[model samples]
Target: GIKGAFRTRIAYVVQTNGGQFPYELRVSDYDGYNQFVVHRSPQPLMSPAWSPDGSKLAYVTFESGRSALVIQTLANGAVRQVASFPRHNGAPAFSPDGS
Candidate 1:
């Protein structure tokens, strides 16, 4: 027997200007509904990439005079710093194996 299921969902991250704090990361649907903020820091955030499993996201944040790579989970809103460098660390791309 063959069993299958169908699911329709879409998500995207948006960046907005930051006054005294850093930029904000917002997620919305394809039809531009259910808009909500995901992350916000004292530094600018950019390049939000979703994981292959759609369970996590990798992005960059500039707070310590440099940019740092951070991975955030969408389930419980847990974030972890993955990598950091002395210079800019923007544009995070996930691998094929989801690393």
Candidate 2:
């Protein structure tokens, strides 16, 4: 019951505009339909990885001028800033256990 709540479909971020200063993170079905924007930032998005069960996305972004790691839940569009350092933070990956 709880597990199925967020298991709608597979998701990944798509960037248009030639991956320039303005980029968009879009999520869609594995078949490239039912697409929607998960996040958008002026900076680039890097190191997007899915959780173990494929329900959440963990990614790195430069939206704050400095690199920061963010984890977003795909179901309700809830976002949390997980890692933010003084200078740099990038290349985020989720643990096998989804921690």
Candidate 3:
């Protein structure tokens, strides 16, 4: 037998430094509590997407004059560099198989 527990969670993307130039990724509770930064970059970071299970996040970062895709796990706070393009790589979406 399996019992499904109900929980409330909220996810958002925040831009650091007031979105001046270099932006960042942030997530928090539904009531705007427990706010935390998920990803940050001195150059710029944008377009954050959550995994199907909500256990990980995928985002793009521009730090080396190019954009790169990075996936971060919410459990242990581990990040994995997935892809990087020469010009720009933005907006990452996770597949059904968690890829």
Candidate 4:
């Protein structure tokens, strides 16, 4: 069996057919319990990546009419902008050390 599987958690994205925030980022335990929406946006959300320590999540968003990268702190639901390039930006992932 996988080590520490019982404590594993996961993050995912869900797109609604129509809603104020059509894109939703969600998280849940390995067994699907304790599920909740982590973030929501009117634009598309993709690449849900958890920090190595599991305290934060990083993802791509187009909320500004341009693709950008953002990091969200799970504890306080605080979001910080990481990058927003001229044309586009995407695919956010934390370094091995969660930097």
Question: For model 4, which pairs clash?
Answer: none
Candidate 3 structure quality by residue, lDDT tens digits, 26-80:
7776677787877666776777787877788888877667888989998888988
Deviation of model 1 at 16, angstroms: 4.8
Which residue pairs show backbone clashes in model 3? none
Reference-based lDDT, each prediction: 0.71, 0.75, 0.72, 0.86
Estimated TM-score for each candidate: 0.76, 0.72, 0.75, 0.88
Better of 1 and 3 by TM-score: 1
Cα displacement (angstroms), candidate 4, residue 57, comes to 0.2
Per-residue alpha-carbon lDDT of model 2 for 1-99, expressed as tens digits?
346313555555556665444677776666677888888877778777777777788888888888999999977878899999888787777776789
The prediction achieving the highest lDDT against the true structure is 4
Alpha-carbon deviation at 49 in model 4, angstroms: 0.7
RMSD of each: 4.3, 4.1, 3.9, 2.8
Name the TM-score of candidate 1: 0.76
Ranked by lDDT, top first: 4, 2, 3, 1
lDDT of 1 at 81: 92
Model 4, 42-91: lDDT tens digits are: 98999988887788999998998899899999999999999998987877
lDDT, residue 28, model 4:
91
lDDT of candidate 2 at residue 35, scale 0 to 100? 83
